[model samples]
Target: MPYLMRAEPYDASIGAVRPLFFSDLGFTSEPADSPSNTYFVRRIETPLAVRRSLFSGSAIGGYSETSFGSATLANDDGKLDWLSDLDWDGRLVEILYSPQERPALADFTVLFSGAAEQLVPGDEIEIQLRDLLVLLDVPASRGQFGGTGGVDGTAELRGRDKPWLIGRRRQIEPVLINAANNVYMVDPAGFSSLLAARDMGVTYPAAVGDFASYTALVAASLTGTNVATSKTAGLIRLGQKPNGRFTIDAEGVKVSGAWVYRFADLVRHVVTSMTTVTGASLLDVSFAAFNGLQPAVLGYWCDGSSVPKVRDVIDQLADSVGAYWGFGEDRLLSLGRYDGPAATADFEFTERTIIDLTPRPVDRRMKALKLGYRPFGVIFTADELDRVNVSAADLEAFQNEYRWTAVATNAAAAGASLLATEEEGKTLFDTEVAATAERDRRLSLFSAKRKAFDVVVPLTPGLTVGHTVKLTDSRFGLSGGWRGLVLEIERDANDETLKMTVQG
Candidate 1:
């Protein structure tokens, strides 16, 4: 791991790029995680990373720590004299030494607002500049000095891939796509038409390449030989007039108030609909294939009023396919996933890959699976919505199939557990099969967590979340075997230790 730290804040006022000259500074960012855009810095001279687009707001955020450490500064004149020209808001604090592979050393990492101290001469003038984290919360005036202004009004609150930003005391959310009224259309006409529509807006083959296109992938998983028009469910309600535009809080439109989609068409439609949410493209796609992931078809609803966040929608949809979706550098705009074979025990690990390991016990695995399908119309005036649920015909086969199987739902309350919500897979019958497939994939050695652990290893460059990794262990009968998905990675840039949450 080569040591590199650089802070370049654009000076929108001057119309040029200026690099911050840091006596010392460091930054850490995780584009893969939720709210992937953020950084922390402490510096000696001037702040970097500022932009006028964000006026009165310093690009640098702040953090403080006490009861942990101390810091003293020498004046710029290079003497024991009091510190001079103190501009704490955006200056990079320099580090004389940075040690690599040392998790305990915090020399070249971000700072915390806890457990620390800074000492300056009595005569010295000190200024406090914050890191970008604190910068998001600007203009803290208005409260009568107790100083806890509920939440900085100007601050942008984001989750998944959407910004839950406030305007006039209300949340303005990204819009959701309505299938009947979206940029893409549902064609009951089958394969060629479907492919044509997918490539319609394309100017280059690479731009709309067939490589892992969700449409192409779902086509592979198509249950029938071709599109079945009689079973296809069309839209009952498109949305408000300005289709594809964003809206505030909203719910998925009822699926034509009925289930008419051929199972194959339903899967195809939902997968295709997802790709239309703006900025759903990937930064880079691969020619390689991997395991534990198969090209999957997922079912979801798209409301016409607002455009949903691309990464967020893909994430929720990917779950249906036992796949993953998010950015690499993880900008608000981007998507990625691995759809291939069942998990094969690969990527062997030993002392070299495993830094710290802890074992945990998993209580139960579902033995039976009952997926409930709620129809589009007529909410139950009766006590149970279960009365009308469409059930999978093959629940018993699952019990005879898996090793440590538990019912997907309790038998008496069957049908509701997996299909608990009114998800718009209006494609009936086979949704049960899709849901069951998700369950089987989850029960796999790479997907199941009958054996699990938390391991802190060096950052493996290309490792993305939701991908499978093999852990060789003999204690839990995992000597000649053991593999699991990388559920979460706690990236520690300052400490240089990447902690991976494993499940299998």
Candidate 2:
């Protein structure tokens, strides 16, 4: 006997609570002028694809194998089709309840039986079920529309299925034209037409009679456009003044005072080449005339209050564009303090003169050191040698004792012969006697030669005053000692000398 059991409620906060489905949300409105009759409704659609479970079960009846010659068993397959359509009724719940604000949806959970006791006898279950629905709401203000600025209006609401309709109608406004109070009353179309006509070379018309003549003259001076009222009177007039004067109310006004008249004079006198008369040329002429006018006139027009009244008119004329008239391109006219035909006086010639008498001569054999070349030795003559008390023997001794030669091949032979023949046979007394006799003979010959020939020795070529040259091969005294210069180069009447002024 089985006892009955009751099913208990599960916590909705857990995963077991079920969810509800929502179908649509939107708005409707009526026209303001015909609120009772005019109606409009907007539809929003939501379609959700249902999901299927992946698992199924099958059952089979048991049979005896001994009686089984040709018997077959049937199979039973069961699936949970009911779980696929599990409806969710409380899927979307509004939390904020403001009348003007749009509704907000809350989240939900599934609810189901947990134990097997919840099922009836012989019942089979294969899958679990759950659901969720999309939620949408229309704001109360947009759902019902009225008028703006007394014009009837209507709008349709939409939901999640048609999101483009939200807040779109409120974003439009009308544009107004010519609404400012300070605008002028001139006809825009007529002003544009006048500008077009002017661009097409049409001139403004003048009034009648003398007033028209005066106005036309003034306008002609300002801009080079002529306007005559009557077709019979030509707009342009040309004539030559033989008397160069016009009787105007018994007063004389120079025609040069008027820029237009002066410009005409310039056109005739200077700018004869109409082919070269361009806008820039006309502007240059106008600026020149304007600058050349009286300072009061110039100051009144150009606001140069600081310029002097008695400014030089020729200075202004020299600055003008056509001031070079009648002058060749190479010839320029001066107008300031330096003005005159440029002087062409010839350069004068005084007598071709020379000053400071002195002597200069050329002699190639003088042995004077030329400029930029250094001399190996300087020579002094005999008269100059007397300034220093050096005798001729002193210089000859230096030259002979300091003269050098490469070691000779026969030097060893000569030395051997001398030592063997002379040195081997000598007693001390005989050697001394022979050396003294030879020395006496040399002294006597040197003294006689010094007196008879006045033999002056040449200066050591590489030695200079106060400088020394080494004597490595001395015939007498120690070798490798230095010889010194005693005097500088000088010339006597007949010979050159470097006297032995000192010895080292």
Candidate 1 local distance difference test against the native: 0.31
Best by the lDDT measure: 1
* CA lDDT for candidate 2: 0.19
Off by over 4 Å in 2: 1-259, 262-265, 268-276, 279-290, 293-504
State the lDDT of candidate 2 residue by residue for 1-504, as single tens digits: 000111122324554643311112332222433122222211102111112111011100011001000101111232322322433222222111112233222111111111111211112321111211000011111111122211111122112111101000111111111122101111100110111001011212332222123224223322222221211111111121112111100000122333222212322212221122233333344335433431111000001112211112212222221121111111111111101111321111111211111112211111111011101111223332232334565333222212121111223334433322111111111122322332332222212211000112332222222232232223234144323222221111012122222222
Residue 387 miss distance in model 2 (angstroms) = 99
Residues 58-97, candidate 1: write the lDDT tens digits.
1100111111122332244544232332323333332222
lDDT of 1 at 191: 19
Error of 2 at 498 (Å): 68
Can you give the lDDT of residue 389 in candidate 1? Answer: 30
